[model samples]
Target chain A: MHETALTQNLINIACRALEGKGVTKVNSVTLCVGALSGVLYDAMEFAFDAMKQGTVLETADLDFEELPVTARCRDCAYEYNPVGFPYICPVCGGRYFEIIGGEEVYIKNIDCIGDDDVVTD
Target chain B: MSQIKVNTDLKALNNEIAAQNKEKLHSCGILTVDVLGSPGSGKTTLLENILPELAAKCRVAVIEGDLATENDARRIEKTGVKAVQINTNGGCHLDAKMIERQFEKIDLENTDVLVIENVGNLVCPVSFALGEDLRIVVLSTAEGEDKPLKYPTAMLKTDAVVVSKTDIAEYVCVSTDKLIGNIGTVNPDVKIFTAGKTDGEYRAEGLVEYILEARKNLK
Candidate 1:
């Protein structure tokens, strides 16, 4: 829903990261999106495509790596990927568990071309 | 051609501001609660019932977030407590920056509890931390029993779940027990409360008491 705002932030962060590097163009931006992050992939891509115009990332391709939900049972100390709703520990049927992964939206890295990489016309 | 490593959480800036908001509110001895739910999930109605009771115990202020309209803030003000309205202008959630901007308008030192009614959304608001001490998700019986499971991320991030409008559960063919049970399935540790009219009186004493207790525990 707030993908537009988030995409703007993504651009700001990338721009800041490349400020002093003499980068000529951004090639791609990689993001790690979790299953439970509540970020709709299609919406994010749409927002990126629209908002990236005129920014430093105008030509950058947005790449996403999806991570599955993982949890650890507090009772039996069992760790496993949760497959369905009402996530229960497979080993002990314990409902009490701590989510250990798949709730984050992280900017992994960016591929860019430095000024040195551009051939003279 | 180079790949620069920039491993950063998208919400890092918001979280940083949230931590600052927490410290500032805590320093003034105020307990903050962020209320989240879908539109028409009875979030405002629940607050209308509980705010009077909460105000009697301590100074209470409310920050109401809506995509548009001052209606919610007006409703809150009718309880005789201060209410600040934040119109998101179509934004889906309230971020830490928005909450921080309201601090100057509110009498922080004199307030004991600040209830922030977030823009009615079960998705986007769950990701943005607003520096509140407690995050409460309000779910109505009319929304059905599968809401918690369908929106597990919202349930998981919340500290409490309030099943509102329970008075009409039977009329809606929804069981409050099943709803509460489903909530526990997704978030076993979350404190649950129910609010509705029973025998011609609004009931949410458990929720009121819970908030009071949370305020008392804030050191």
Candidate 2:
């Protein structure tokens, strides 16, 4: 349900960006979904599929890029991606750290089809 | 075909409004805090216990965000302070836009502290900024100690982590020390405190004191 609201924001962005571009339809929207952003890819795509209509993004396909959790250890300042379970620093075996990445959720680009039957990336 | 670089933060517009809301609240001398936790995690109960103590020091107002019902709002109002409820009506979390609209219902002139009780969810609320000065996540002991590990964003982004319902810690498998250790794994700087357990009339005092201490961070 949260994804639905967030996906609306993405759709709005596409609409606003292509407002005066003479674009007939949106081909796709590329998004970066961070692991810590708590956005579900499938859920967001489902939302976009259902909600995109009567707008520039009516036919838009959502392309997602999954970003892994990246953090730096506090004890040893070791940067590593903690995959699963036992989150520990690979270099110094430190258990404590702060997440520095994989928290951003944003739109990267918009691919659309212009009025002249030309597809724009 | 031309490719346009949107490269825009999806939350940029919302954050802009949130920054504006923060300034508006601060200019009115109101300190805002977002209280977050999972469903049935004793968030309302903790507030009920501490509202008097907090109100005694400053005029407190609550903005309750829930998927449905004005239940939390009614509960907060019983404490004899201003309360407004925003029913998300199926939304999982409260965003800045919702807060911006509902905040106007509460009088900013007399309000010294504004506590926004975020919708019950460990996942989505972390992504939305509600123009708050601080964020507190109340983790009930019954919710398991692995919560901090599972929802690291909620713990890391929050200013404080309150372990609520410690009186029943004996009934639960999670130990207090391990819970604190798990919190350190994500955010070592987050203030951790045990609260919401009492034998005689002073329930949630620790949590109240913790919240009062956080007032120093307010502008």
TM-score of each: 0.96, 0.90
DockQ of each: 0.52, 0.49
- Candidate 2 lDDT over A5-121, as tens digits, reads 888788788788887778766678889888888888889888889888777788778899888888889899988888864568899888777779888888988877676754344
Pairs of residues at least 3 apart in sequence or in different chains that clash in candidate 2? none
For model 1, residues B1-219, the per-residue Cα lDDT tens digits are: 878889888889999999999999999999999999999999999999899989999999999999999999999999888999999999999999999999999999999999999999999999899999999999999999999999999999899999998999999999999999999888889999888999989887588888989999997
Q: Go through the candidates in order and give each one's C-alpha lDDT.
A: 0.91, 0.83
Docking quality class, candidate 2:
acceptable
Second chain alone, TM-score for each candidate = 0.98, 0.94
* Residue pairs clashing, model 1: none
- lDDT by residue for model 1 over A1-121, one digit each (tens)? 9888788788888888877777888899999999988888899999999988988899999999999998999999999899877788999998888889998888888888987653211
Worst 10 residues of 2 chain B by lDDT: B196-205
